[model samples]
Target chain A: MLQTLPTEAALADAPPKPILQLVGVRKTFGSFAAVENIDLDVREGEFLTIVGPSGSGKTTLLRMLAGMDTPSEGNITLHGELINDVPPNKRPTCLVFQSLALFPHKSVGENIAFPLKVKGVDAAARKARALELMRIVRLPESYHDKNVMKCSGGERQRVALARALAYDPEVLFFDEPLSAIDYKLKKTLEKELKDLHRETGKTFIYITHSLEEAMVMSDRIGVMRAGRLVQVGTPEEIYGAPVDRFVCEFVGEVNTIRVKRGPDGLWSGVDVPGSFKVAPPQDGAALDEAFVVVRPEFMRFLGPGESADNRLEGTVYNEYSLGSRIQYQVRVEAKGGEKVMLVELSRARALPPGADPHVTLGWDAADAFTLES
Target chain B: MAITHKRRDAAIWGWTLFVLVVVYLPIACGALASFNKSRYFGFPVKQYSTDWWGKTVDSIEIGMIVKTSISVALLVTVFSVVIATFGALAFARYDWKGRRLYQKLILLPIFFPQPVLGLAMLLGFNAVGIQTSWMTAVFAHMVWIVPVVTLVIAIQVYGFDPSLEEAAFDLGCSRLQVLREVTLPLLWPGIWSGMLFAFLLSWSNFPLSLYTTGADSTIPEWLYAKMVAGYTPMVPALGTMATLGAAALLLAGGLVGMLVRRRATA
Candidate 1:
């Protein structure tokens, strides 16, 4: 079943077996279910990110995986050994908190060396390890004697990561550690975190609401919605080929054209005046009605003598510059009502400033995939 | 507008100074009169002497009362701080049935009339055949001081971030280690202030000590007895010592709190 996945085929060889497995795990708080019947396998040394909106149970699942909270049912195993009953301190895993939770009363070195101190490591050795970890996290040596509270938000985040690493756990869990940081710093930390993961070779299980962060760092992304793991795959698989409308919309901006099958077994756009060519369903199921999902970047303005599998006439009402790319909102009159289609193009390929407002937008059939709505 | 705002600030400062003098003048006068040569506590003393201070040290009865007060206060402070800190930790960290009711009940003694509470405790001790000694006074003092300590510590506990404990545990520390290394260190200011309050309250309490101390009279009860018999500069000397002692404790507590806060922020 896994052989059909593009990610699996692209791998150098058969990927390593999972180091941790969660089978039918469920957690309930009284009558309310925080996480329900979640099954996942975490490959050794792989960076996996679970992305979801708030209250979607991503944190609940991470808590159970980190051993801070026990599952109400099912089993969790590490290296094929059942560990559902283990407490966080007894387990070989550490969780970096959303708030970082660095000790304000202690210096940065002392905070990082706390785990070592608990293991009864001597003073000299602890200091050496702490300094080494500070370097690994790109923190200055002078910060070792400074109090954790004096450090800026991003610096505190690095201190927290260094502390979590000091535990030398088999797996490290992160609970939106970058949510409190500014955008510019978050971007830097995101790349640094991916580099750190590669350097450490430890399994990283991170949870966040930012799919962009997941796309940037995760080897595989798990999309969660309402206490359930809706889909789990590589970033390319999640973004280019989402399983449903929810996954497609959650990942990035998408344009969906509703299409219905005609008596001749050809799919026709239900709203627009003409039929639209769409790629066959990836699942190979014959569908009477489906949504043709096309990303904004895939849809472009057709030039003179240019052709595509599907084309529609629309008036370009507004255009927005998003750094290197320009997004155009084209209003098209359909049989049902007026519809707006988003088209994005690079700055170099953007329409001329004085171009006619009435334009033809088109996308190749191969660039758009069909999914049952 | 700026000139009027400056004038308003000056007026506020003047009123504050006036209120401070009004509130503290009597205590300052009493402290000063302790060094006067005259037996009566009259203003505009003719001469000053250390005779009353010397008398306090020389008197055996007064010495024993001071010893009793010190011992009782120490015992009450230790017991109250330990019990209250544990209670506050439980209240801060967990939710259980009747938690609010238990919290209210623990703090109930703070609002009770001290004389009535002392009387009820004395009666209860008599029914139980327990003799009223310095230990009895310590127990009575605990009843009043424990709630205050708990309330003070609980505010700090409430402000504390529980995630620090979780982080500690995640870093391979046991529950006991987390409490010892993280929770208690962060709560040092609250514990220090609570201990000071407990000791001060127990040492200075008069009404509660009146009924609880039978054979072993505390300093406050002894001083009250002396006041009833006659007026003396020695009484003022004792008051001066007590006031100085309390002021020293407050100063020490403040200094420690400031130092802790500075270290935390540094």
Candidate 2:
């Protein structure tokens, strides 16, 4: 009785509550479904990023979470309260758009103080709080009296951030806030945003089209494709164990080859011929059609006597220097007539130009993931 | 390069000024004729005097006409601008059934000749047991001015970014609050311009005021009746008075506009 009662008592110790949750949320416009069956939980003091291309429903999902839009058929709950029918103004969340919509006619102080003003705070207190927020956002106090339209693009961005933070919501959503900034500034802002998230200890839900930005900032990354969340994991998990070919290609560069399963329960793919093999058959495959996903860095140019579980002999059709690595497109005949195999090598060990086109490519059997068509 | 551009600009300015003078010569001549002391309209004056100005002041009918015109213009300007501001906001924000139809209907009164509109409005009001009075004159003037105000303000509303209102909503403000805080502030310029236009159209209206005004005599009607009956050298003096009144309005409008521009820039 003591052992059983003690386990139940031990389990009573709990973590903090999730700040935001979306349960089976979907949004449809006319006949087109924009966001479908999205279930997400944002924990306290976490920076979660949703990455996808255009029309991928990432922004639509963020909009629902922000209460700017209502989900068609599911519940969006914040702090354990259902918020499906709540309008944006009633929700304790703020969203920053790509345009950084600051009121051009208002001064920087007024722009940052808008939320407080709406709450009927006295003018002097509002200005003081706005100045405090400006300091936190690292904008000069002198800029407060200046018109928002007169500020540079970066300063406007800071004003917008200050305005959103003025609401002091438990959760904040960003809609591609850095997409319009220059490269150098974007890099700096990315680091600053990461530090800010840590400093504020508020949950941040951000949507962006750039994977690099997501990797730079997110504690957890969700990859979306065609209105569905495809993969969710840490940056390293997404890069190394992508759920599908689409997720693999979306996160970074990858090489894919068509394959088929032989009756011997072995996997045979094109471009590498019978010399290469794959373990385990893909589910729901017709015994004859398959594809294997391989990242470029996994494929190596073999030296004499050095060997791998899979190997291919091919002529190097083209080669390019990529920073400290050399990548080559090797044309070879394997299970079928011809295919292209991407081989990458460290620049320190690169063979001279003439040594390519007369080379062997090899990889471990487990390096390639096989998917059935 | 700036100097060359300025010289070309000055040459264009000179030609445009010349053309404007040519076009305005007839009005200028009429104003000049008002100063003549002849009982009959003549080019050269027998002797310039204040006789006509005194004559106009002595006529109680002309004085009443001036008062009626001012009241009617003021009423029409206030009402038309208010209604058109609402109409423009509706058309700008909501896309629904009959939007295009409503817009077309606003312009219909403008398309008809003023006399036709005046006659139709007179008959319509009479049928409705609405007696023609100064109020009816205001209504008729409003019919011509509302479209002008609506169209101008609608153009400004259409150009306005919808995000400003949305941003206000995001900041925990109601729809009406958004209008008060965001829409109206950005729309001040367009609304002011529309109001000015409506005021000008109502102030200068003649034919519509003619039919709808029964016992109340607007300035144009009073002037028309006086012109038909007899030759008073004071008639041209009244014309000069009217011109000066119009110039005063234009100058006030200009000053208000400049003040608004300077405040906005500051």
Candidate 3:
């Protein structure tokens, strides 16, 4: 009767509460559906990123989550209570807009303290909180009186983040805040955002079109396509085992071999003519038509006697130097005459300048995964 | 061959200075005549005195006319700015059915001649059987001014990032709070410029006030009346003062703008 009793630490380590939940959410304009059938349970302290290319309805979903818009159908609940019709100001959530949307006329302090000021907090308290948030965001204290319009792009981004943090909302929504930043700064901010999430222990719902950005900061990544949520999983799950060809291609450049299942349960390439060894599907389903996706990094050029689970003979079409790695364009014959396949290698493993143009591309079966459709 | 860059630059500067001189010539003439002792104005003054200034400043009728002009301008400035703030938002901020048509209609008053607009409004007032007074002059001034002010503010509204208001609302600000905190402050420069335009245009307006104010009189109307009838030195003296009043306001606005900019940078 007394067996298997849990300790206090075990109870504390229980899965996070679902702070915000959406069930069957859909948004539309006239006949066009912007977002549809969105069912998501945002954990209390998890960093969730919804990623998609432009026009994929990610921003529309963020708008509904931030309460700037309402779902045309379905329920958005907070703490298991329905809040479908609540306006943004009434909801304990804030959005860091894509443009940052800092009050240009206001100084850094005033901009950061806006949410507190809106709630009727006195000037003294607002200033203290603003300064604290600024410190959390690594803004200089001297920047308090500095007008936001006068700040550089990166500094203004910090101001926007601090302003959102001033609300101390249960969940914070970022609408591609880092999208406009240059690559180097974006990388820095991405890490800083992850650190901030750790420090605050607040749920963050971020939307961006960059899978790399999502990988850096998110505990869970939801990939969107068109108006639908295509896949939701951890970054590792999303990257290593994408659900389909679209999810796989959206993440990064990959070599996709269209194939049909032969009668013997082997996969025969329809595009790139070959019998290729393929890893079973992630969901372990039987498939007739499928694609085998192999990342460029996993692909290799086979030496004279080297072997792999899969191999294709081709002539070197072109070589592209990618700084740390070199990618070889291989011309392989298929059912449709000829096609180009990619083989990537580290700079150290690059073919010698006078090496033969003829080459063999190879990959282990485990490195390539099969996807239906 | 194209004009050389140096020659083009010199020509541009010369044209600007020439335009400035031409614009200020009438003001300089008014100032010169204001000091002339004789009633008639000449290029070179035979004698100079401040007698006209004393007479113009001391007259109760002139004082009442100044007060009426100030009242009309102030009223028009307040009403037009209030109406134009919302009008500007509607014109440039919102996207709704028929917004294009609404923008065109609001701007129609600006296209018509001021005198024609004044005559049309006078006819409207008469048909409605409303008594004409300085208050009616206020309405006529607004009929012409509101469009100009709305245009001034709408340009600012167009540059405004509407997400600032949305961010404020998401930060727990009510709709009115967003206006007070974000929209108004961001549009302050435009609103201030619009206010200056409304006040100055109303203060100097003659044709509209002439037709609208039947029993009452404004400074510009009185000045016009005195020019063709009494022809005293008071006419030019008051004209000089009116010009000076406008100049004073502009100088103050510029100074305030400089201070605000300095404070913002600091």
Every candidate's lDDT: 0.90, 0.82, 0.89
Give the per-residue lDDT of model 3 (tens digit) for A97-123. 999999888899999999999999999
Give model 1's TM-score versus the native structure: 0.96
After superposition, the stretches of candidate 2 with alpha carbons farther than 4 Å from their true spots are A1-16, A263-265, A275-289, A300-309, A315-330, A334-359, A362-367, B1-18, B44-46, B50-60, B231-244
List the lowest-lDDT window of 10 residues for candidate 2 chain A: A1-10
Q: What share of the true interface contacts does each candidate keep?
A: 0.91, 0.51, 0.94
Using Cα atoms with residue i matched to residue i, what is each candidate's TM-score against the true structure? 0.96, 0.88, 0.94
Model 3 residue A183 lDDT score: 89
Estimate candidate 2's alpha-carbon lDDT, on a 0 to 1 scale: 0.82
Q: After superposition, how far is residue B100 of candidate 1 from its true place, in Å?
A: 2.0
Candidate 1 residue-wise lDDT at A301: 87
Candidates arranged by lDDT, highest first? 1, 3, 2
> Candidate 2 on A90-118: residue-level lDDT in tens?
98888887787788778999999999999
Docking band of candidate 2: medium
Off by over 4 Å in 3: A1-16, A281-285, B1-10
By DockQ, the better pick of 2 and 3 is 3
